[model samples]
Target: MDAMAAIKQTFFQECEEQLAELEIGLLAIQDGDVNPETVNAVFRAVHSIKGGAGAFSLDDLVHFAHVFETAMDHLRAGRLAPSHEVLKTMLRAMDVLADFVRAARDGGCVDAERSQTLAKELRALDPDGSGAGSEMDDEEIAFEPVLMDQSMFDDELEAAAAPPVRLFTIRFRPKATLYAKANETALLLREIGLLGEMAIACDASALPLLSELDPEGGYLSWTIELLTTQDEAAIREVFEFVEWDCDLDIESDAASAAPDDIDLAALIQKMQATVEAELSALSPPPTRVDPLAEASRKDADASADPGVIDLAKARQKKSEQAVGEHLGPKPDQGAAGGASQPTIRVDLDRVDRLINLVGELVINQAMLAQRVMEAGLARASGVATGLDELEQLTREIQDSVMAIRAQPVKSVFQRMPRLVREVAAMTGKLVRLVTEGENTEVDKTVIERLADPLTHMIRNAIDHGLESPEARAAAGKPEEGLVHLSALHRSGRIVIEVSDDGAGINRARVKEIAASKGLIAADASLSDEEIDNLIFLPGFSTAPSISDISGRGVGMDVVRRSIQALGGRISITSRPGRGSTFTMSLPLTLAVLDGMVVTVAGQTLVVPLTAIVETLQPKIADVHGFGGGARVIAIREHFTPLIDVGRELDYRGENADPLACVALLVESEGGVRSALLVDAILGQRQVVIKSLEANYRHVPGIAAATILGDGRVALILDVDAVVASSRADSAAFEQSLATAG
Candidate 1:
């Protein structure tokens, strides 16, 4: 690949990894469970990506990296603790960084407007105040020299005979008209320094007397002796820029000559020809030289007055203007400057490949352990003990690799505050966003998928669940409504709750909307939970008029779909005139899930353990049809919606075999329900989620497919979609019964 292509690829890869690490680290920090090492890791991940981008001379990456690295530096040094506001701002900055990287990868310039807005948000987090200068003392200053060490060179020489060093004598002479051009000799020299070491001697013998001099004319020349481990082609790079401007000659130094085995004669001849071509380009025609010389002399004489003007300050101002012009506006320029933080850009595909490899290794390790147990090799010889040790080591390695993929949910959480502000402003609701447990660690894939659903839920909480400012005051609550967003580990799953303390979902309005939308009949008697879930129905909205913020009847349905796509579920709990909480339970990682492996009519199926509330064998008397094939089992006084999986999947041969069925109670749009009629309950295991879209296509009731331990592909049951489909069927059947009556 070309330099730019390689750079773009590397940038995106590094960005993905950095984002993952940022999510996990921020989540841990927000949960108050992160350590100094974790904080440092998070900071370093961002810093590394920035450094890599800088290496490619990408300006947009450098600009944002500088700002983001500064904030992370502060956090790393404990100057800034994980606060709700700071974390939110950091998250927003990360989003901007992601955007910039994406734009750069696509060969587009950074989005100036979005970048400026995000930078302002990041700067506001560290406004001039209490903790400004405290973190400086703790910042670590470290460096990695690019030069090869003498000891390493010696060791290599001892292993394989040392390669011959080449020395070249180079003469650089600039053309008389060269000074008029914008190119600088110093910059050229700096570029050369990146290649090798050299000694220089300036020749000013051609300089004329002060009276006869042209100040702007180039008179100086340099003879340099370069001692490099690189060949003659490398030496030519030093003088690459000045090739057209100067007279150049290159030859091998006799003093540094090695054996005849390593010849330098041909290399020296090529270097001389390369330099000559470059120098010839810089030489101008002799006809126009006199006028330029005269102009230079006159200009030099006119500026001879020592006290004529404050030229230094004028030059400084001009330089500042030039910098401003090149860099555009400096929105956060006043905050601080001169922070040395190294960053690197990595290719996200590579990181993803690495993660996949690690996941495979984990699976292989499990397989090996299973084989060892089945073989009954505990009493075997030394090889058995070594295998045990290897297994332990493998486990540790797998854990470390998995840790590299762990990212905080902070970046995903960060966009919420701005969203909340916007939605609140639009709805005229005074909503204060209270974020907790932002540091919850999740895989990168999960974090990316979670952003949209979280955004919709937060918007729903502010717009629909939270009351208006005036309404809040009248209800004897604080004038400003509180929307609490929290994430925590609950039963091995990440539970994210978007709760609002305002007038909760009005059940009466929900029922009315549901009735009008034909989602339910006017005479249908539903529990409070079922009534609350009516909000998730497609085309169901209680709002009388649609607004720009929401209530076009599309938010919750999308949220539900998004959550389900991630192999997660969304649930709601509410009290009339109080507030509502939308709880989303998601797996820690999307790559693999802890699933209950069960067999239904000889086909193995995986049900996400998170969705399995309680599995039981329901008595035949408990299962009864209300009307028109709508089955409901009386669980205490409340009736639970029941569906027979065997009948639903069209499985044959056991429709009425004692009516013994296992009920996997799952939550959905119609609230919690015991899914009746499954053949048997199987053991639970962690199964890798494979995309059905790759081989086949999406099946309505099947969320995804996973490979069972026995190598059979088992479909992961989509409890929510199945429940929704079953409920729709029940509603249709009931309507038919009404028509028949």
Candidate 2:
């Protein structure tokens, strides 16, 4: 793309970061954080976006951001209370602002009516005009909205046309840091000028000649008189982001100024001085500032000698001191925010390419080790030792590549609150979304694909798992329902859970629905867990009526399929009246696996080591025939169902004798125990995962395939599917035999 387009792309990338910060700060405030920096951070986010959008001529973004920033400015200066109502308005406005920004970047049309409505609400909350006459000399101003065409903003305004104008003097001085931040003084002047009739006065006394001047130095200040119907809060908002970077002073010059002898700026200065001194005593030192009255003066030295300005050095020193705070360090980091943990954004395709190369390196290393052993090298030989070290290095390199793609799940988690809000509004149910462990890291690809399943599952939790308000009340639950989401690393896998505090899944209802849909026999006797899982059967839904939110039986099945496609498994657990939790276990990365290589029906197969509990040679006494062809094995005082892996995979229809085969004690996603019978145990190793579905069509009993050290391809067994299939085939065989007899 062209350079300008590339620069615009970078700005949008920055916008994403700023938007995240904005949301985080707002949530903190909503949760009762009173940190001044929090408000400033939020204000700076919007202000930066506004300034950047002006550069690209994103007028829609600039106009809407202007109104949004004004409301936030009031909160920043303590003019607006951070109450629940006001904060809610700001939050909604923040979302709309985000929309406007995205539309501007993506070349989409924005909903101007929504933007205009939010702008009106934010304007009302500004505290500049809403209150009745008070004791203050200054008055809050409001604009009777003027009619406009539909292009920039909606013509449907909340208030009427502009009635009159109020004149005020605005003092703005630019610091070196202001220009350093890429803020243009002319842009500010032009935007303010658009609001009213304005006269700009420049002070050039601080400027030195070409021989002595530092081009980057702050040597200019301006006094502007603006006659407009806009409120003073709106005027002050133009400098919100750079307020700390420059000296900004605004005052009312009208006769109606607070019936006091002192002007607004003087009174504000005295109150601020006392407040700052007290604050400094208890906290950190104050930021830099300038004497407002001195900066606002139009007269500089009309009688200065033409050769060199008197006290040029003194004026330079004063101007330097009068210059506002420098572009300082981030609050959490050191004084320079530039020293932030250095990071680079790499393309996803590059990361994937690197991972693929690493996987190949692992395979080559394994092949080299195999050749060394075959060549009769001693275990302690130099060649063998080097090969072992090579293996170690390859593994480390693979891990490092995986780490490059590991990202916190917070990106997906951050979108949940909005989802819960939308669902709650649609269902007319009050839901408080409580999330934890959002910082748990997972593969970037996994996190991206996991969003849809989690979204649908969360919806299912609230709609199907949670009881209605009246029902919850009767069941001794809170009037307001809660949907909880959490993620954590467990046993080298990322386990995410979506749970609710409302009524649990109704097993009887679920079973009836499954039966009506012909998913199960009408009179079938099923366990509670089985009934709970029935909801995942395709076209199975218990909603009484079809509606926009959920009724038509689509979500759960898709959720299950998507999770499985990610090499993950999902299960559900429910307590009658308490709640229900849907847990999904996904591999941290799909590129490699720790697997146990074993021989099954004369073929090498890999079983996920994470699924295995133990291996044993089952004694004849411990094996007992159950129904039809099914059997159970006793291990550690527990009788677990046993499935012959060879028979399940259709390698041989007949069951292998227990004496000739080994039993692998394994657990499924639902914690169901089973003994998988295979021929002989091979060895455990890290196998680079190769997708069988991508190369060949998917195999039902196999998950994926991997290459052995000796260049043999082994199918990775889907232990869950094998264990589940055995029960179904056995039940069907028993039913058929009974019918034939």
Candidate 3:
């Protein structure tokens, strides 16, 4: 990529992070958290985007972000209240701002009408008319501080005084690191210039001889005398990004605030002398002197070569580290105490490559261990012990690599509040979205795919699950319905739920729709659970009419398929007049799995360990034949459906005898338990998952394929699909029997 393209890519990547923060802060404000820091963060997000857009000369994006930033500035300054109407407008504007960013990055066009509309609403939020007009011609609008006209004051004296314009003498010296971050002294000075009338003087006394000078070294500083109504805080905000990379000191002089008549050169010299005196008094003793400083002094005294400066600085840094270790851990070093750790951004492709290599290492380790066992190495033998150690190391390496790809689900969850608001507005429902466990981590790939299914589910919740305001009021519930979204890790998988406090699935209505659509027999006997499952059937719809949000018999069934496509399952539970919850359980990573190896009809298969509850040998007395060749296993007096894996996958023509097979008790995503009958148990191991659909083709009752220790490909069982297929066949058979009778 060219330099401009690479920088633009980085800008957009940073925009994603900023956009996430913007949504989170806006949502917090909507939730009644009007903390100053929260408002500041929100303001910074929009301001940063506007500034970057201006740099790229994205006129439309810059214009929209300017209007958006202006309104946020009002919110930050308390000129606009975060009332419901105002927050609603701000949220809409936020969505538009996000669209503007995406449009800029993807070379797409935004809806100008919508942008203009949102811009007008945001401008109207300003209590005064200052923010109500277009000032695109004012190039400084992005950096201009929020200020009120002095003429607005009632008292003449107050109007004349206007706010005391304090004089600040700021000394700014930027190191090479500052420029390395793409920050420029010229821009920083320009921002300070925007604050007020200013006189700036450059100090170059520290500059080394041309022959001795390092090109990247900091050799000059600027001292500025500014007279402005803005305080020290406003001046500091301009330098926030480069604060750690520069030495900055801002001194206020309210008594002598004149900048026009001051002698800048003389004043800076005097200030420098005073600062040097103070530093000398506080300096460490000679024995503890910084090596870099000593080296510089020696170079001056003996006229030594300046080439040793870098080596001395390295020595100084090393000495500081040694002393810090000798002093032991600092009280502030505790991670639990909230010390910020440094982080670096790496290309995601690199992390994925690392994860792939770790997965191969895991497979190779398994193969090596298998070879060792085949060679008849005893468990106590050194070779066997070494192999066991290697296995443990492989697992640790795999886990560490996986952690790199694991990201919090917050990225997906953060987009839902916006979805809920848009859906509610479209459906004319007063709905509030509540979220929890947003920090639950899952693989990046899974997190990316989660957004669509989650968006659909939340939309379904608002449009279909929730009732209109009047309906809610008539039902004695809050006029505004509530939709809750939550995510958490359960049984080595991420489970996300979208639930609503509205009149839940009307089972009668659901059944009627199913029958009318011919999805199920009109007279078929089904439990409430089965009726609920009917919604997952293709072409099933309970809505009376098709709408933009839902209906057309497309959403729920597609939701199921999408979830299943990720090796996941979705289930729903509802109580009439109460609410409904759609729960989805998905694997944390698609790359690897912990599975139990089992043989069925001489074919090996891997069952996900997360699904297995226990393994038991089925007794003859505990097995009973059910209708139409189905069987049930009695466990603790409860009869659970028993599925023959061999028969279910058509690996064998006949159902296996339950008593002779090992019954693996497992729980489905819906919390239903069943016993899967297989020929024999072959122990459990972690297997690297290979996508079956991508490599081969989608196989029924099989989730994916994996390479075993013996170098044979074993199919990984889709436990839920197997159980589901069995129930489906049994239901059909029973209906046939009813017809025969």
Candidate 2 colliding pairs: 128-140, 137-258, 329-335, 329-336, 329-337
Q: lDDT tens string, model 2, 436-465? A: 998899999899999899999888888877
lDDT of each: 0.69, 0.79, 0.82
lDDT of 1 by residue, 559-623 (tens): 98788777778888987777888999876776666678777888888887877777767777777
Residue 443 of candidate 1: its Cα lDDT? Answer: 75
Best by TM-score: 3
Query: What are the runs in model 1 whose C-alpha is more than 4 Å off?
Result: 1-346, 354-403, 513-527, 541-548, 609-643, 652-655, 658-677, 681-686, 709-711, 719-741
Worst 10 residues of 2 by lDDT: 298-307
Tens-digit lDDT string for candidate 3 (105-133) = 98788898888889888877878876555
Best by lDDT: 3
TM-score for each candidate, following the candidate numbering:
0.51, 0.73, 0.81
